[model samples]
Target: EITVKWAGSHPDNPLVKVILRPGMQMQYLTTHEPDDAQMECAIAAMQTVLAREEAEAARATDATEAIAAS
Candidate 1:
């Protein structure tokens, strides 16, 4: 699973950790490495991801229903 989590503090950046696994095999990266200029970057990313997932799930359900009808 993919997730964005709190890493720590930074003087200039939001310092977020993007974790791409559960535990030991997890890989971490940060958007703070390049320092996002927008203060709402994290919030915006979250909203976009959630919206996209919801849309995809709806599309999948619709496709399943259409196939069942045919």
Candidate 2:
């Protein structure tokens, strides 16, 4: 779900790259400039994902501790 298109014809494409999954070696480049709203939405989505990951990790840790205490 990349928010940008390819840098095919844009001579002055921005030199920005976003790595979504380093383990899987997945990366994306944003050639076209995104609007302010789009950028904000993207940022929000990323933050949400990070929060979910953190919450899941915390839950897993708690469960492991509980099992160990039993």
Candidate 3:
């Protein structure tokens, strides 16, 4: 899988690309090594996405359960 987006609102060149392989290998290609701040922002962004996805999945599960009970 591949995804490209900004780490946050602003940076020298915030746009980054992430690539993942079936074996769980990951790659982050950039002109320079990411600083602590940039890594933190990226982690936060990933967590936010995961939280929203989990909430949506829970809602779907609840809906399915309700339908089964009817």
Candidate 4:
């Protein structure tokens, strides 16, 4: 497992944490502040990472199937 933590000096700075599996790609963003902007940014970042992970998983699955069929 992979874990990441971000700390900010001020409440506005925002903090983020990301965790992922051994071979999986995952991104998590966390903020100390309750501002909408900070939360929005975090969400966007997480979404981007998730999309990338999904694409990678699909590619791996396709490769595995091809190998098994051959």
Best by TM-score: 3
Best by lDDT: 2
Clashing pairs in 2: none
Comparing 1 with 3 on lDDT, the higher-scoring candidate is 3
TM-scores for every predicted model? 0.44, 0.54, 0.55, 0.53
Global Cα lDDT for candidate 1: 0.60
User: Candidate 3, which ten residues in sequence have the lowest lDDT sum?
Assistant: 14-23
Model 2 C-alpha lDDT per residue in residues 13-47, reported as the tens digit of each score: 55423332342253244345889999999999999
Better of 1 and 2 by TM-score: 2
Lowest lDDT 10-residue stretch of candidate 1: 1-10
Error of 1 at 39 (Å): 5.7
RMSD of each: 13.3, 12.8, 14.9, 15.0
lDDT of 1 by residue, 1-70 (tens): 1222223232234333223234324433332354565647877888999999999999999999999999
Which tens-of-lDDT digit does each residue in 1-70 have in candidate 3?
2232332323344233122232233233325688999999999999999999999999999999999999
| lDDT tens digits by residue: candidate 4, 1-66 | 122323332324423222223223322243245689988999999999999999999999999999
What lDDT would each prediction earn against the true structure? 0.60, 0.68, 0.65, 0.63
Ranking by TM-score: 3, 2, 4, 1
| Candidate 3: residue pairs that collide | none
Mark the regions of model 2 whose C-alpha exceeds 4 Å error after superposition. Answer: 1-31
How much does candidate 1 score in TM-score? 0.44
* lDDT of candidate model 3 versus the reference: 0.65
